[model samples]
Every structure is written in structure tokens, then in C-alpha cells.
Target: MKKLSLLILSLGVLFSCQSASSKTEPENNPEIKMEENKTMQQDVTKKKNRIVVFETTMGKIKAELFEDKAPITTNNFITLTEKGYYNNLIFHRVIPNFMIQGGCPEGTGRGGPGYAIKDEFGPGLKHDKAGILSMANAGPNTGGSQFFITTVPTPWLDGKHAIFGQVIEGLDVVLKISEVERNKMDRPLKDVIMTKVYIVNE
Candidate 1:
């Protein structure tokens, strides 16, 4: 009887230690730790990005500004939108299967908000797909209120332009605008105006 009691006590301690070890194994696992870190980064990115809605004459377009990736360019765009600077602005330049350029208050692609901002480029940001929102600049570091939304991947403009945001909804509307009739300068034959622009903190 004494021997049996001692054996039972030993087994209990062994099982208890095994259970404790298993509980802590995941906390020490490198793979699990990496996954946890990745999830944290994703949450941070979600909090940083801002949603913007563009109510154009053609249709409504929704976009997400990559504030973390392009702080300067995103700030400039958000500031302008908050100030109603994009209201009534026309998509001055349009090309089928290419891009639609706008945000020139002058409606002639020669105006700005009385200032220019430095260019921002990142490895993760690129004109790799349609609906990419990028700064329209004449040369390096000349970005201002002018911007464009690509209707197709424009890899050539990757480092040349600052990618600030991407259209999440209303891409068909962008495609429609791109197919509109334009003149010699690629300006839309009839105005495709941005009736209203707003920002959502989420």
C-alpha cells in the first residue's frame, strides 16, 4: 500500500510539470512570437490609414490614404481635402487605360495650393496596379495639390511619383472616367468634376 501511494504521487507531479511546460511552450516558440508581432504591426497599420471619399460628377470613389508609408504626401492631401480645396475640381487630364489626373484648382493642370511639397517614395509603395493615387508633379520634389489615379499599372512612374493613397471602391467609375472623350492635351471633353471630398478617421 505504501509503495502504491508513492507511485501515484510521483505520477501526479510528473503530469503537473508536463502540463505547465506545455502551457509555456507557445510563449517561447519563435514561430508563434513572429506571428504575434506580425499581427501587432497589422493593427498599427490599420489605425494609421485614413479613409477618404470622393463624390465626383461621374460617381463616388473611396480610397485609403497610406499615412504610414507616405506621411508628407498624405498630410498634404488630407489638409487640402479638409479645406474643401478639391471641391468643383475637374479631372483635367484623362487617358483611356492609363490614368485620370485632377486636383488642379485652376482646372487647367497649372495651379496649386500656393505651395509645393517634397516627394515621398517607399519600397512597399508602387504604381503596381490600377486605382493607385499618386502625386502629379512636373519634376522631382515638385508635388503639390495635383494628383492622379492610374487606370493601369504604371511601373515607370514608381520612383518618380509619390504614392499616397489607393482607391478601394468606385474603380469602375475611374475606368469610366478614363474612357471619356478627351482633346489633344488629354483633357476630358466635358468636365468630370469632384463635387465633394471628405475624410473618415477610420
Candidate 2:
């Protein structure tokens, strides 16, 4: 009788251990699967999103556009840049220690994309300082591809220019280009064109 009882206890312990191990294994498996799914989702999102590159006459500037934050602004820029609309467009206005404005197909400050996009603001983006690319418009809701790059902090433009992308490289190029001669309106006396604009991923 004692031997039989001992055998039953051993079987009970073995089954209990197996049950515990099985339960723990399922819990860990689900967690691992959830993590894998999350990573896959992130990778898919990144792959779908594109990184835009602006090859200016001064130099190349890269910007990782935020589609999720400013979808309308980002999409507008992507469409315009991809269509070669910005190519050869002159930096019409360049104010010392202020900002440089462009996006006129005719290389004049009065040109535009022929259509306007609704303002996408309050995304925590700010036009605080230099290298911050933003929209150029006569008034709110009038932005139509005309944009600017700051040479210095233009506090007055904080809420004016719709903060889109920023210059991630070759900022000195803008400063040097701005030093070029300009008319009374700060428009470049001699046209400084953006040779070509393209998108590149790093």
C-alpha cells in the first residue's frame, strides 16, 4: 500500500510540474508573438513612408518628412518635389540673418503651385529657428508650395510659416548663398537656382 501511495504522489508531482510548465510556456509565447507583431508593424510603416531630399543650387539638404504629423503638408511637398516643380526655382528673397524664400517655378517670389493646402498645425512642430523649412503665404490658408529656410531665428514667423521639414545637412550652404547680392526686397540680385530636387533614403 505504501509503495502504491508513493507512486501516485510521484505521478501527481510530475503532472503538476508539466501543467505549470505548459501554462508558463503559453504565456511567454503570446508575449513573444506580440513583440514580433509590433516590430513588424513598425517596419512596414517605415518602409511605406519615404524620405525626401532637396538638392539646392547651394548644396544638398535632407529632410525626414513626418507624414503622420503633417500629412497634407508632407504630401504636397512630395508631389511637388517629385514633379520637378522646385527645379531651377530661384531663392527670390534672402534676408540676412532672417530667412530665404523660394518655390516659385518662374524663379520669382510671386509664383505658386496653383492650389492651396489647408493648414495642418498643432502637431508640436514649431518654426523656431534656422534650417526649419516652412510654408510661405500671404495669409493663413494661402500657402501653396512657396516655402522658406531660416538663416536665423525669426520669432515673428513662429506661427506664420507652417513648420514642415528642416535642413539636416549643408546649412552653411544656405548662409553662404544668402551672402550673395540681393535687391531692395532682399530678392537675390542674380538668380540662385535650385538645380534639382529628389528623394533619398538613409
- Best of the candidates, lDDT: 1
The digit string of per-residue lDDT tens for model 1 on 84-198 reads 9998899999999899999998899999998889989965998999999999999999999999999999999989999999999999999999999999999988999999999
lDDT of 2 by residue, 50-113 (tens): 6666677667766667666778988899889888888777888888887888888766677788
What is the alpha-carbon lDDT of model 1 when measured against the actual structure?
0.92
Alpha-carbon RMSD, candidate 1: 6.1
Model 2 poorest 10 in a row by lDDT: 47-56
- Candidate 2 global lDDT: 0.80
Highest TM-score against the true fold, candidate: 2
- Model 2 misplacement above 4 A: 1-38, 41-51
lDDT, residue 87, model 1:
89
